[model samples]
Target: MIGWREGADRVGDLRGRLLDRVGTGTVDIDRIAGRTLAEGLDAPRAVPDRSHSTMDGYAFAAGDDYPLAVIEADVFPEDDPPELAAGEAVRIATGAPVPDSADAVLKREEAAVEDGRLTGPELDPGTYVYERGSNVAEGERLFEAGERLAPRDALLLGDLGVDEVTVRERLSVGLLATGTEIHEGRSRDLDSPMLANLVSAWGHEPTHEGSVPDDYERVESRIAALAAEHDVVVTTGGTSVGDKDYVVRALDALGEVLFHRVALRPGKPIAVADLPEHDAVAVAVPGKPVGAHAVTTLVARPLFTGESELSTVEATLSTDVGIGPAGFTYAVPVVLEDETATPLGHADSALQVYEETFDPSVLSSSTRATRADGFVLTESGLAAGDAVDVVPYPAVER
Candidate 1:
């Protein structure tokens, strides 16, 4: 098995190769959030276009003495103001375009205007002025290829007069569950629904293709069909070395298995494959619910979102937590409160499943474990008060 970082890197490389297959299209700026840019974008025009006023005051060339002549007309955001002569000022509203000859704005509260004369404290150049191209310069590189757009990015694009953006098309994901108990209706197909929600939240379309038994031929056939229909096929369960674990075998027969497992506890059996024949990718995750969520977000997310970086928050551990193994990196779920993180399944916590050591096997199946606010990835044991970076659920879920 490879390390988790290496697994993420491999999946990111797969995304680059699959970029062309996914293609690109134009989307309205309002709908561009969560989409990856297909090409780098240069600012078509400078933001604000020209120098303006940042406050409702006077505008005039700096380095001039006070008691200047006041312009008769006021400048609002919608109207352009006339040029001002030296020792002259104009009443300007916020966002109003400042005249080319004017640079300083004296606040209305400080200015004394009487008999068309304006007087205020000494002013500096560019004071209270929004300089042209200060926000975004013309021809400046705004976004790079493969950069994912956030909702807040719309504000900048809108200011640049951009109504639409070219972004890579969203990947279509097919969720498949493999287990006799689930296929026969004796057990709930928990992974498919959760996987579907995750794929959608990652800005992709997910279709729950339903479950198939642990039959080798059946698993192979269903995977082949799903691969042909979707850009990605996400299979849950049947990833171990057991006789009933046919997902990995089927993937190997259908395509190239990039890696079979990762050095991650509770999620070690994750697998990624490239289905070249069908022009699709397959990610096989362990059946355990918590493990499935952890592996997919850490490893498979980059394939869909082109993002591998995890946003983390620093917190103090409230309890000592130990790992069972030395080589594996364990994802210990923790509840964050008042800048302190308490391991969810620790004996001191509500679950009370483990004493000092983290039991991933049991915790992976515990639905209560989902209540964790985030998780800490640690290779060694953690002591109380130790500073750790916690990857919040919202960081990966979105």
Candidate 2:
């Protein structure tokens, strides 16, 4: 893991990452709530004529009667439905629209319409009928750009009678994992789940997910094919100067490498390169588990999903952290108290085993972590009382 400064320097424009060939698409309004404006092709709908209810009640000026008030009835949303003259009441139901001639409504339970005359107990003003346009105002901006549309967003659009929307097409980032020693889980042979996982976060899905086995030709072919099929391409492993690192050669073959390495620990091998398409950027990360995880938050997140840059909040250290590496950065995990954070362990590329819990399936009832909150230890050494920042892991929610 890289220090806070090293991680911060690798982030890209938040909005630019969202600009990967988005276009109008059809989606029910319900899903828009959690989705960003870039994913939802949305447009404003013409205001719809809605009614408070269809109830017909005594419409009369409020406060005119305490125990009894002179009332008139008859109101509808339509033009010229009926008029309530002075000192008279109109019988309305639960859903009937209040007549323009009426100002307030006396509920049927509260008033009695007997023998063509209405009488009701006294009530407060503005008790019965709904005010006009109380639900929505005329000419209101429903949704703004860069906002994620949620279920309510879709419902609101439907309520507004909007059918079609103009939106950019969701982005598609190509996923490429470099290195020969890197291996996916047991079931995956050619599938790159790290790349595949980017789909949901990055606004697009992967068309291909195959790892390059440290061979320049095989890696180059996969990257080229994916780059052609998707907006952006990502590669894991083979990013450092190891003999098996093939990402450098593959990227050089495809397009120009913007930057080959970042001055950070754990993820120092990270490289951000340009693709053939506009706004298409590819990030190459190391093969280590922690390296890939850290790189995802730093380079992958912004390049693919346009998510907020890695955020840091203050906490106190739980243990003593001795950082002897000179001029190097480290991402450490800490146990957070009310505002104090406790260092969990030393965070290094090869030190992820500390966070892993025993696989109950493999060894049931093992004394390992069942759950943990991911925390980052700054490059600065820390002690039990030292201050730190706790960034919740992506898998865990605060």
Candidate 3:
């Protein structure tokens, strides 16, 4: 099978697979902030509006107040307040541009204005108002090409008065959850919609969200429908060799199975397939919660993001940790301090995902403080200080 490792084909490698972002469109600037540098259009992006209103306080030239600014109330004569004198304090609102000839802003609260007689403490030396482009430099690189649009970034767009962000189009994703016992979307239950939360976190829109019981025909149809609609398809459960393990079968019917098992811990039995119809790719994650998370973050993440490889780090084990059974990939949660990793106990895949939140697994346990920066695979055993590779959260690497 094509895969990555010593001798296998590098099915999981993404280097050349990343798509060059095409024509850009006007997106709300707020939508593009704080996303990773690797998750954006494959080109440079220019911001729309540079100036924004910051009502906190209006700026003015040094020594240019009509009177003294009272600490609480606003400066009077809203418009054409006065010709800014060298020592005058004009009553300006929080967001109004400061008048020239005044270098300091006396916060209304900082002063006591008596019947328009402005009197306040001597201001600092430099200009007190927020300068234009002070927060964002002119031609500042708010985002390079291939950046993620997150919540914080979205707010920035608002603060900057950015109307639209020229960004790469959204990556199309097909989500298929397979399990006989797991209720389908029709159930409309809380647990059934869990994967949707994780999918949206990374910026991929779910094109086909459905479930298939242990049936090959249903799975096949789901695959066919998704292959036509999306660029990548991700299915949860049914990846193992069990009788209900129909994902491999259904995928093989559509295209070639690149690899069935990976060396990664906690997420073995992961498989990759290429569908020719939609020019899309597919990955099958095992049913176990941990397994499901592993495949999505490690394998599917880069694939959907069009990144050629995953992100990982070098870590030294601080304690002896082993899988319950030998030869199994052992994925452990670790707390990072410098180059050392402190293992979090009870790291089995069975932990509750939502109740507790770890970087890799959802848990209610206090171990949320302890995170799995990444995972390491082992066949024999490891001692404290053993050097290991820790993969970080994955996204499309631009």
Q: What is the C-alpha lDDT of each candidate?
A: 0.92, 0.55, 0.55
Residues 1-398, candidate 1: write the lDDT tens digits: 89998999999999987877888999999998789899999999987799988888888988878789997889999997898888888889998999999888887888898899988898889899989988889999989998889999999999988999999999889999999999999999888999999998888899999999999999999999999999999999999999899999999999999999999987899999999999999999999999999999998889988788999999999988989979999999999999999999999998888999999999989989999999999999999999999999999988
For the record, the alpha-carbon RMSD of candidate 3 to the native fold, in angstroms, is 9.0
lDDT of 2 by residue, 227-345 (tens): 77666676776777877677877777777676676544445677766765444556677655544555566555644433544567777665556654556555544455587654443
Q: Rank the candidates by TM-score, best first.
A: 1, 2, 3
Which scores greater on TM-score, model 2 or model 3? 2
Compute the lDDT of residue 47 as modeled in candidate 2: 35
Per-residue lDDT of candidate 3, residues 1-398 (tens digit):
22224212344353124334223455556565333344333112233222222334433454444464432334432432344544445556655545445555666566665775666565564434555455665455566556556666656666555566666555566777787666443433222244455556656566557677878899888887887777677787777788878898888999877778776555667788877655667777766565556545555555444344545678897766544444444455555669886555434333324221222223212233224555554565667779977655443212
Name model 3 segments beyond 4 Å from true. 1-82, 85-94, 106-127, 164-172, 176-194, 201-225, 237-260, 274-277, 302-320, 323-329, 333-398
Winner of 1 and 3 under TM-score: 1
Q: Give stretches of model 1 more than 4 Å off.
A: none
The candidate maximizing TM-score is 1
Q: Which residue pairs collide, candidate 1?
A: none
